[model samples]
Target chain A: MVDPKLLNFDTLSVHAGQHPDTDHGARAVPIYQTTSYVFRDVDHAAGLFNLERQGHIYSRISNPTVAALEERLAALEGGVGAIATSSGMSALFLAIATLMSAGDHIVSSSALYGGANNLLATTLPRFGITTTFVNPRDTDGFRAAIRPETRLVYGETLGNPGLEIMDVEAVSAVAHESGVPLMLDNTFATPVLFRPFEWGVDLSYHSITKFIGGHGVAIGGALVDSGRFDWTASGKFPTLTEPYPSYHGLRFAEEFGTQAFLIRARVEGLRDFGAPLAPQNAFYILQGTETLGIRMQRHVANTRAIVEYLSGREEVSWISYPELPDHPDHDRAARLMPDGCGAIFAFGIKGGRQAGRKFIKKLKIFSHLANVGDAKSLVIHPASTTHATMSSEQLEKAGIGEDLIRLSIGLEDPDDLIDDLSSALRASRK
Target chain B: MTELLVRGARVSASCGGREPDPSLPLLVFVHGAALDRTCWQLQSRYFAFRGFSVVAVDLPGHGRSEGPLCASVEEYADWLAELVEAAGYHQAHLVGHSMGALITLEAAARHPGRISSLTLCGGAAAIPVHPGLLSAAQNGDDIAYRLMASWGHSRRSHLGGHPTPGLWMMGGSIRLWERTPPGVLASDLAACDRYRRGREAARQVGCPTLLISGSQDIMTPNRSANPLRNGIKTLAEVTIEDAGHIMIVEQPDRVIDALDGFLTGL
Candidate 1:
């Protein structure tokens, strides 16, 4: 009976959620590719359906391979449980759908991934749910925005593209003061850099498509529950505290206790939404997670080297990496993410949008993609791509400048990366 | 959910989705230290739907029940006896786990006629608390939770393949402990430590007793239950392999099977 708390993060990343296959003794997690499981008998089948026992019945609800990923993510995040989804967007949507009903509201950071912004501002409004967006740095703004109908307060660990650090502890305090749970999108920081739960966050979701799945192969997401929120105490979340008619009047909080939220997300959200991660994708993501610790260390180191290079370059006008003393959130980032401020940052070129385009076009080592957290370096000019539709004034309001070029540093040799950027910088200036 | 007024405190119990029927046999589930009725979710629901009435209780000051913590196992036993009667049961088949096993033993010994049968899961004749663990819990340090969760579960459970799909057993256990109010764990540990009349209680219990042990239970190994096995004249025993102290969640199905077989025979 060894104490598992003694196991370190790197060790858990490798061995947390899987054991060798009993049937074939396979060392790697076997992909249980089947869609359904056969029951032992009629009684066993009944027991499973009624929640009288624990086992998988359908792949959409749960699968052995997917379960392994779910458990591993839960362990890594220090969460009680997790649910894996087909994409990062689905994980976000599932949580929202499970927690919010028609006539409910959310308080969110104005700076968010474009997809998330659209989901909260545009799409969910069609479903009768509204959002109030505030600056991630404004802790008081979050509290002031909370309505009696507000059920959740949300933000990214590091604001998307702008590199603004969220004061998680202060904002989480505001959320809890108003009797709402603080939720964080931890796609940029991953648990290696910042564990949101330890900073008073109640729930966190990740785009496993990013850092966790370091290689740019799989597109998946996961939502983790810290299981510290008391749903019944607030009486705001009837979906969890009251009887759920969908599952034979089972009261999630009563029967599952701290696990109520994640259980409801899986049993109802996945059952209806039907956006489960494929077993093959889960296997790929699991493999990526095994090397997460080492990969993140290199990613942070390489990012530091690039930030230093960009700071001294004649073709660069400004930099937004938080570790730089001039960045507005430098002190906050140092406190929250002492290891490193993560691998993604933004900087301004000597020229504007055209220079940004030229610099991206000339780069040989960095791929020009609308994504971050890949093993290979990635460069995206948000003004001409993700935020291209925004007017100059709108871009400024959102903290994205026309001259801003976002860089997601990778595991490549620093010298080769610096050389590639140097040639591209010269081309952009000319 | 059912609420009963026992000794002026509001006691909460899960009735397993059905109201107690006077004509049906009664099953009462008691959870271990720092845990609640949710631990008995599977077993209680199974029996509740299968021709029996179930009451999985949250002991005073635990879960939904309101209280100043019970100071000793004998006090908790007396409270349980009152709760059973308040729920309109004359006799019940009591099922207890770890600290809960001690409570059931004391209850059966004190009021022999009220308990029809006994099932002690992870029971021991004596439980001696570690001084360091007691101090840690007394100060409300989270290390107490980590130690219990890591040691309570078998090694295989750490790499979770939970019967409940997508659940991390060890992580869930820690979260459950975190939900308990401060000082409750220390109080429960103290009560378990102070309990010293297991052999006398076992000798006095005339009900058909079943002793369920986990093969890998380091917290309270099978050998520790030797006094109960020897004292209880009509005792039957079952050992679940590869299970640790918290077998109720670690290997729920096996624990259920053992209970189902034993209760059906009785």
Candidate 2:
């Protein structure tokens, strides 16, 4: 098998997990929509069922299109193998389920996406697994939060809307010292800008909804295993080390080696939960991945221009782009994401809620929608809509204030966008 | 000649009631900002049996009536008058809520010849300016949750711990307010600032007006009702005992009773 780390992302996107199909000579991956794949014989089926063989038996376990996406993602992310999931939340759920069971604990960053934050801080406690949330930038914070039962340390590479860049290497160091793995959500900072594996991350997940699809048409997620973590040696991941009653005593780590985490996630997690991505959605995302390089480059460029434009406006009371010269995280951003910061940033208007409402209403070019990652510009007020369920205290803790307006820059002409925003700002101020 | 349409401007649908009647007296409803003509669903249908034509109009940038959203209540009223004229109604009864009620009063003030009577539900001659709301909106919390928290129900109404759709109403209200074009809200609020449609405009209205207020309405209280009562020389009043600012949804029965009694006198 070819090592993905050796190749460039642009090249890997097109060629990974894809070859000229020998039977049909199909260049494009054909969607194998069938529920089950037939075997050569009863022995072949037995081996497949017994986990002794490596062939597709059930679509729930894996589909050809989903497998292609998995392989392509694994290659792009520099991981040994990957698992595609129904949604981003499901991917996080599966990752937690695969690694930690009852009595286990997780250490995570406090400044997380609201949904993820709620799930970790509030929801997971209901399931008997307590989570210790600390600042991702604190290398010692991760270490201190870890209890004896801590199985993982998790954080997002570039925190959503908050845009706080995590020191992945520092967190990884803390996790490694305690015989644990670091999982990073690389959805915002796609491999195009920053690959987490390069910073010693053991696992990375993506909410393919954002940036990856480049369009907000399909909702999907992926989990990429770095294959560097020795689950058997760590002895912390019992599912990987212990005998499997489901597959007739087949130990995952010993049998599948680097591919153990992904295989188990597919067969045990996805198969039981039935959260596999549809072949059509996988196809849509694949098309989106094809233009990843160009889209991300333009997204950064447009976002920088927008940040600059909004910062200088008299109507804008505050701006929260990390790339701003005086921003506390600018230096950290420079050291971490040297290429450019991600496309999302938040700003406040001078007139407060009324002015903000007027500005959004006056916007002719930008679409007012909850979704992001569309080829078109999108805007939202986090406090009033997405984070409306959270209390003011929760919003403050997450660094989200009511005045904050998030902008997801798209591949539009930056000048036109600036003009539209300028007109709206001028109108709002009056 | 009173015509009603639900999804379009200048046409009237049968006041949607659970009854089978074609010749009901029309209760033409004109909704305020953040709501379409569909807001009269409960009233129109409930009173459809009383031989009433329940019709509602979507003001410009409101429901099906599309345009650059109006900047002021006067502009919305002006548009409502034109819609009434277009519907070929020489005289029709009117009911409005909040900003819609403000616009309805403005419409009655502008085109008295086209209106038979008016019902202002949870309305006032003036809206008090909230600095925190304007500040928060200007600063981009256009969703206006804090504003909703302050302006929605009276403190007593919200003492219950159960979550209700009223929360979504606050969210919806903010979204609707925020999603307008720039200067639109400023213009609307500015219109409110410039409005002096108290006893004077009501007196000039030259038609019977009914003022229905929610007891718990923070936006418009019984004190504000003094303006409508003093203005419309021919005016009646009904206070929804325990309702909120959005009395139509909060106290539908009281609203209907007020409208029923007021309309019957005609």
Candidate 3:
């Protein structure tokens, strides 16, 4: 049998998971606005509910409009399957819920977003799952942290705010040797700049609200399975390897093979958690994904120019970017994501905390906001905003500095963004 | 939802539960050439719920089943004979697809004691491999996988509307075939091509048999499947329209309903 030709990524971005509605002859993906689908017959309805067939029974489980976005994202990432969630936070939670239950553990990078850090350290323990946070730089710590109960090794392609680079290939080796999957958060790098799956990371997720969505308008996330992990071989994840009593004695691994993890995440996690992506939001993300590659290229190009401008300024006390030659993980980032390190990173101001706030307040064009990856530039002071409730020790442990100002470079002209930063720096000084 | 290690062959299967219920009839599902047991997902889940203990086997050396690749369809059949006993079942109702069907046909004929019956979905009395396709698999060319997957499904499947809501059936099938380890596909294709005993073995089989053929199947058209009807006694044929070789996915509901109905009658 000859194989069907697959369109390249750029082309797939435009067409991968969609086709014209044969009945309606609509050119664009119609919003499957309804919550339920009409079954052809009683047997057909039973077939869908029992997972004997693959049609949508309910929007909360799977919807056509959202399925289009999910399939497109899965194609873009080269994953076997994907489950779209309400937000990146929900995606991570869904992944964890699918892989483990009470008594299981995870080893994660200490350098993480505040919300993730809290979820791992505090919130999840209340649910009986626990985490061991490790320094991403200590490659050995990842291996050493593995316990018999450890189900996954977690890291980000680019650590939030700090831009700390996780050695994916190196960490993946540790994870595989320990017989657990490695899940990476690739929101910052996106697939255009980096794909953790290529480095042997078994699963990856994105806050599509960021690069994949390319706009801050939609708050959604996606979890993708590389279809590479062997749960039965590992003999650790009973969740995937054993029949779920709640789901009618259905065994995910036996039923879905390589895609067992993702199947369970959708069948159990999304169904029970009820954090399904709205069809409207899914369309918004789909529109953004269509031009992800081009937008990311422009964002990276503008970012490098802005970083260069900031590095030469007297008002900047220090600049932290993996692209900087002197950065600790510069070589590693270059090897893993040659396209770019990321569009968001942190920098320290010469005048410290008070001046850092003034500089952000002084920017006219760059909006001071909590979100990132918008077409318009944005700035945030993590210590006062995302991490305000944390104590000094907690903030320091997370690598968040009082003087650090985080910038998420946008698609604006590089010179305009640079000029705005230049004026803000001058206004905040003496 | 657990791993079952078949003794001696070191072959493993993804089983539906921690332990197979002895009182229940065992349904062993084998995959097509260059594919894994996951292809039978819809059937396995449905059968498991229908009071059958299911085990989707990753043929020796494919998927999770560590392989010293079985040299021929006969060898694979012999291995299944042992896997049934090793899996602690008195006998198994064997279901195979494509290359797997050839193996099941041979096993039921040779080791009838370990097999309850046979169900061949998308199989024929003889399979002739395209020379270029065989050459591609031999070279471990990924193009061979794509070619096989593209031709495996009907044109309607190319623009997919799988019963499953979100899956791009064609893309999923391509990715599945691409996961075959080095020489597995080449060996599997050669085994199917060289197997000369399918029609002869069907004549020797002393059990009920079912064939679910796709009306639009280009790989094993009606002409290819006709010889089987002449060879087997008490045989049944159910044809699903608008489906190709991969009818299990292209028209999963129809394929599944046929099996469910046949088993219920049995």
The most accurate candidate by lDDT is 1
Candidate 3 CAPRI grade: acceptable
lDDT (C-alpha) at residue B110 in model 1: 95
* Candidate no. 2 TM-score: 0.60
**What overall lDDT, based on C-alpha atoms, would model 2 receive against the true structure?**
0.71
Task: After superposing candidate 1 on the true structure, give the runs of residues whose Cα lies further than 4 Å from its correct spot.
Answer: A1-5, A388-394
Please name the candidate that would achieve the greatest TM-score relative to the true structure.
1
Which window of 10 residues has the lowest lDDT sum in candidate 2 chain B?
A: B159-168
Provide the TM-score, chain A, model 3: 0.98
Regions more than 4 Å wrong, model 3 = A1-4, B1-28, B51-55, B63-68, B78-94, B105-119, B125-162, B165-182, B196-244, B258-266
Better of 1 and 2 by TM-score: 1
lDDT tens digits by residue: candidate 3, A1-430:
4544555678767776677887989877889899998998987777677776677888998999898888777777877768899999999999999888899999999888878888898899999999998888888999999999999899888887898997788899999998999999989998888877778989899889998888789999999888878787799988887668876777677668777787788888888998999999999998998899999999999999999999999989888899999899999988988999878989999888889878988899899988888888999999989777677887886788889999999998898898899999998895
Per-prediction TM-score, please?
Answer: 0.98, 0.60, 0.88
DockQ comparisons of all candidates to the true complex: 0.62, 0.00, 0.37
> What would the per-residue lDDT of candidate 3 be over residues B91-144, giving only the tens digit for each residue?
899999999988898999999888888999998988888888899989888888
10 residues in a row with least lDDT, candidate 1 chain B:
B157-166
